[model samples]
Target: MSEEPLEQLDAVDFAVIAFHVDGEWDVDELTLDHLLDAPTLVAAMRRLPGEDSVALVAVDEDWFLVARVVEGRVRMLLSDATAAEDWDLAASVLDLLGLPEPEDDDDQVPAGDLGLLADLGMGAEDLGALIADLDLYPEEILSEVAEEIGFGDDFDDVVGLAPADHA
Candidate 1:
């Protein structure tokens, strides 16, 4: 069957969200209620300062995934790093959301500047789709990254990975 058109996707059901994220940064396994605890996720999506929102997808209570969306795609979002805890709540959320695992072999691969971004993709279209699939709010993190880079411009082209600083 052809993929469902984005427009046709009704508002995501949030009754019992199975939010998920994928990547090394994930902190621990979590439930929908738990992910909701992170107010930043919601605030970023709404583009409101200090405002928070919750995932709208519904899921089985027994298990589900939760995560953050970066650059428009679902990535296993992390709260922070914990050395001893094997149960990563963020990773568990990514799994529930059906997000793919980030390639763990980044260290083995050679990288130049923006190597991490390159892993996301060399083209804007590919990256944009990936970002949209992400569970984490793209605007907030990207804005933060841009500001840190000293660009001080807004990255309007997540599709183009445009260097931005207007955030």
Candidate 2:
């Protein structure tokens, strides 16, 4: 791990809270003082008025996190396991999942449950492949995920991403 503290490395590009209601998806931006804190993020997700809620976060354009709370159970996915070294959110996620902190030379792979969004149409295989694609930025990967889970437009609107051309 680098000598720099997590406070210096943690940079959240955006955080979005999403949930399904009345057959439609509701997406809203979330502002957190400690965006990299897994407990804080999960607690916020759990407080939403829904049976299930999801938080999609992009950090420093280098990694992404998907946290889902279902019936009081929490599931999370971190795009790059190695990010744990530099970000408290990633480290805390590994801690929550009972994963060891990644070593300096560890492969930059994903950690946590890829199936966290399985029931929402983004299965483990699809998510794994998406994160593995190094060509995409964290926000792009999350945008694709939102599309798969039926909230692409809502996510784009909340995050100020230009709408995709439908024509």
Candidate 3:
């Protein structure tokens, strides 16, 4: 048994939040058992207080995952499918998507629901391009996504990444 929790975002000031429509989002922190399979993820999302919720799971500093629940349909997006080989959350997400485990070290395949944020601001092609850009960190990409989706500053505050509040 590993001492580290299965879902802790390893990067500094970066977190996975369950974004809600009503502005009441929460960090998506789950137990290892809860992340082992999809059913538990569905259960966890169902238990959330939001009418619409999405699991914005961070995959280290390099990538992230966004899983949304709407009308009982779970749509997911892995920021960098390559992270699947390294992160437990990404691998579990591939399981949920019914995709085979990623094996190729050179295969930087970005998989799952690419249109998860189509209605918000970014479409599949747009997100795919962003994920392919190796220069940006997951937090940088997510910050842009948050801004596009209308929660830029709030999200920064949630993750304590807000510019230092010098008084």
Report the poorest 10 consecutive residues by lDDT, candidate 2. 1-10
Q: Per-residue alpha-carbon lDDT of model 1 for 77-149, expressed as tens digits?
A: 3322220022233334434445444455222211112222333322334333333443534433343333333
Which lDDT tens digits does candidate 3 get at residues 2-22?
644333433323444454756
User: Model 2, 1-167: lDDT tens per residue?
Assistant: 44344443346788999986667778999875536478878877877886888889998889889999988999999999888887777888998989997776468989889998998899999999989898989888888899888899999899988875422
Q: Which is the leading candidate under lDDT? A: 2
List residue ranges in candidate 2 displaced over 4 A: 1-10, 34-36, 104-106, 165-167
Alpha-carbon RMSD to native, per candidate = 16.4, 3.2, 4.4
Worst window of 10 by summed lDDT in candidate 3: 5-14
Clash count for each candidate, listed in order shown: 47, 1, 0
TM accuracy, model 1: 0.22
User: Number of the top candidate by TM-score?
Assistant: 2
The collision pairs in model 3 are none
